[model samples]
Target: MFAVVLLAHGDVVRERKIAAHVMKGSVEIRSNHRELRARLREAGSVRDTAVEGIVERLDPLGPVCTGVIDGGVAFGVRVTVPYVILGPIPRETFETLDWPR
Candidate 1:
């Protein structure tokens, strides 16, 4: 599945807002042209399930809140396209990120 990562210069709320819009069918998550509404419903907390999973890896750095929207087709080729919102915190607060080494 494809992953959309939005890095904003604003606060956490902005990140959440973008995530919400992307998740709520506002922004197109993928070009596959499949409706992700059903997968999202089955995933329970989209934010917690997808976004938080990524955020957990960044916890050691600082406080970074996340939101996610699922996108993909079902059947045997089911994929969970994740829309990730990254909150910007103080540089000093984070010693390092889970970015590429």
Candidate 2:
């Protein structure tokens, strides 16, 4: 199973909505930062400080941030499997029950 960590600049409701949209194929996987921020703000107020903090924490983890916003609507989404802590593992490992390289 793949775990997806979705970070957004809004409340939990907004985050979940975006996650659902992403999962349902309604929202494109690669969305512009501006668009995302706008959508997030629709749910609630988004703080720049909070967005920056999340970005700083997730950037090292190889999470990709959309670059369509003016450094305001920054966030990340990380998909990984549970129980593995070494980093992103191979899909084949999970399928075959083999050790991840």
Candidate 3:
């Protein structure tokens, strides 16, 4: 599980907790050299590709916690596009929610 947030003009506008199962595709060689070459050609090439996954669950991200670093990765469809966490996070006014690391 990881937290995904949307930031606009240095403020957290929206957030969500996403639980996903990542699926990675692979190519294998079998039999002779001709088959291996064909598979290799068909596989093409990729760089810094984001892994595909199915979202198992989604929950709201309640309040922001200051001083404590929540566990999450910058997620996006394209690797070329950048996502950033900006400015100061607002302190949680209420009791802490059970954060999933």
What is each predicted model's overall lDDT from 0 to 1? 0.42, 0.40, 0.26
TM-score of 3: 0.17
Separate clash counts for every candidate: 0, 0, 0
Worst 10 residues of 2 by lDDT: 78-87
C-alpha TM-scores of all predictions:
0.30, 0.24, 0.17
lDDT of 3 by residue, 1-101 (tens): 23443321111111121112321221112224356455444432221121111111221233222222333343211112222222233355123556578
Give a tens-digit lDDT track for model 2, residues 8-64. 332222333355434443254344545755665663434444445555654545433
Best by TM-score: 1
- Report the Cα lDDT for residue 33, model 2: 47
Rank candidates by TM-score, best first.
Answer: 1, 2, 3
Model 1 poorest ten-residue lDDT run? 7-16
60 Cα displacement, candidate 3 (Å): 20
**Regions of model 1 farther than 4 Å from truth:** 1-40, 44-47, 67-101
How many backbone collisions does model 2 have?
0
Candidate 3 Cα outliers beyond 4 Å, as residue runs: 1-31, 45-101
TM-score: model 1 vs. ground truth: 0.30
Candidate 2 lDDT (Cα, 0 to 1)? 0.40
Candidate ranking (lDDT, best to worst): 1, 2, 3
